[model samples]
Target: MLNPKWESIIRFKCPDGEVHYGEPTADLKSARVWTGLDVWSLQPTDTTRHVAEILAPYEPTTIIGIGCNYKGHAHETGIPLPNHPIIFRKLPSSITSPTSLVELHGGDVDYENELCFITSQPARNVLQDNALNYILGFTVGNDISSRYWQRKDTSGGQACYAKSFDGFCPIGPKIVSAKALQNFQSLRITTRRDGEVVQNSNTSDMLFGVRQLMAFLTRGTTLPAGTLVLTGTPPGVGSYQTPPRFIKAGEVLECEIEGIGKIQTEFTEVNSKAA
Candidate 1:
């Protein structure tokens, strides 16, 4: 059986401008030494600089994004209730960790702080009856978007390009497993920008719960171990606000869930050869 304790993590920033993975430890002295030597000693410290050069956490194999899963978000968008769960994919390259900078382009960026869960096993056609068994954990996510691209239906594709931009999917500080949720059906999701409350809703609003979502996605596709499913976001996404607010450069975005820890990232514009 896997351990039920949730691991809290942060990318350790070294004096040389390098970011290395570090897990929390009971002994502060031991943890600091591990961050400085065990983690960073392995990477090259030669001069390679960008305005921001942080790397995304390296565990998730696939990122599955859910859409309109929250009743409030669905109602606010004026879309009819979905008969089945709506899903999308975030190119693995888009994933970034907490405190990294999310670049905004075309002068507008919107935020959707969301509740996301991870899978423990590889399962195909995961039955709704056994869905909870496959859930390894949950984490914080920011489903950043561009109002113009989404509303105008850019490129005439499926969902929207607003979702596919580089650094658009900001996830994690660490994973918080199912047992931590206490009762998965009752977790709460919250989001804030620069410390002002923007979104507050309960997970109970999910028309399709966590298990159902896993079952729906794996009906035909194989859900590999380490897959992350962003269950969905509530109403109050920046795009839906009156006059439509977008994230400006240097703005802070914070996403959190009751059991899962919070993730904070800043906003910047894309630069050539960006990470």
Candidate 2:
């Protein structure tokens, strides 16, 4: 097994205005730049600098999402627990930095706080017991959604199209290596909107855990290295609220996981002409 001992891996802009991928130092305020290296080709280097801004670690080859994978989330949506993971594809273009602005296209824009993992190596027909070996690390992600397009439009109810808007997925502040987590199933996940905690749950409640998801997804498909997987959200999504609470322009949404860091995103309305 290739277990990495990194506290956190990130892509950041240094004070000199150049972007580089690096691992943060013990203080978590400064980073050691991996000069002339891509994230996958990273090697230990002594060059370090103060971070000016944090960016999304890297562009994933593909972004996969699990829907209604939590019991409470299925109940909230009035859908029964799935016999298998409800898989969906999120376009890589929808990805944005942790603190980026998520533009809404006028309808019920909702938030789904999820635990995400990145693949360390290509996997095909991977077994559950060996799935962890293929994992690089984990991070926090928000599966920003547009309910109208998800449920009422011509392409309604299709998760791929409904959740494929620009900036619909905001993930990362950093990636905590898989070796860093003692127990992946025990971590707590929470989502807050405008400072109010809206979703709170534990990974133990996931109907299908990480190992199962990995095995299932790679059955006959090749999961390329650097693939990102959003392991579903828990209950308390806005569309299921009593009066239906939706994300509006200028609102802030925070998605956090106990072991991994949090990702905060600000919502903005998409201009009519731009839409």
Local error of candidate 1 at residue 44 (angstroms): 27
After TM-score superposition, the amount by which residue 73's alpha carbon in candidate 1 deviates from its true location, in angstroms, is 0.8
- Clashing residue pairs found in predicted model 2: 150-157
1-275, model 1: which lDDT tens digit per residue? 23333343334455567665444343211122123332112232333222232234444658888889899999888899999888777767668766677778544678887878777778788888888788776678888776666654554534446676877788865555566564767877888889988889988999899888888888888888778788888998876788878788888878877765677888876786853
Candidate 1 stretches greater than 4 Å from native? 1-57, 272-275
> What does the lDDT read for residue 122 in candidate 1?
81
Best by lDDT: 2
Estimate the TM-score of every prediction: 0.80, 0.95
Report how far residue 135 has shifted in candidate 2, in Å: 0.4
Residue 88 lDDT in model 2? 92
Error of 1 at 72 (Å): 0.8
| Count of steric clashes across candidates, in order | 1, 1
- Quote the RMSD, in angstroms, for model 2: 1.7
In the range 230-260, model 2's lDDT, one tens digit per residue, is: 9999999999999999999999999989977
lDDT of 1: 0.69
Relative to the true structure, how large is the alpha-carbon lDDT of every model? Answer: 0.69, 0.87
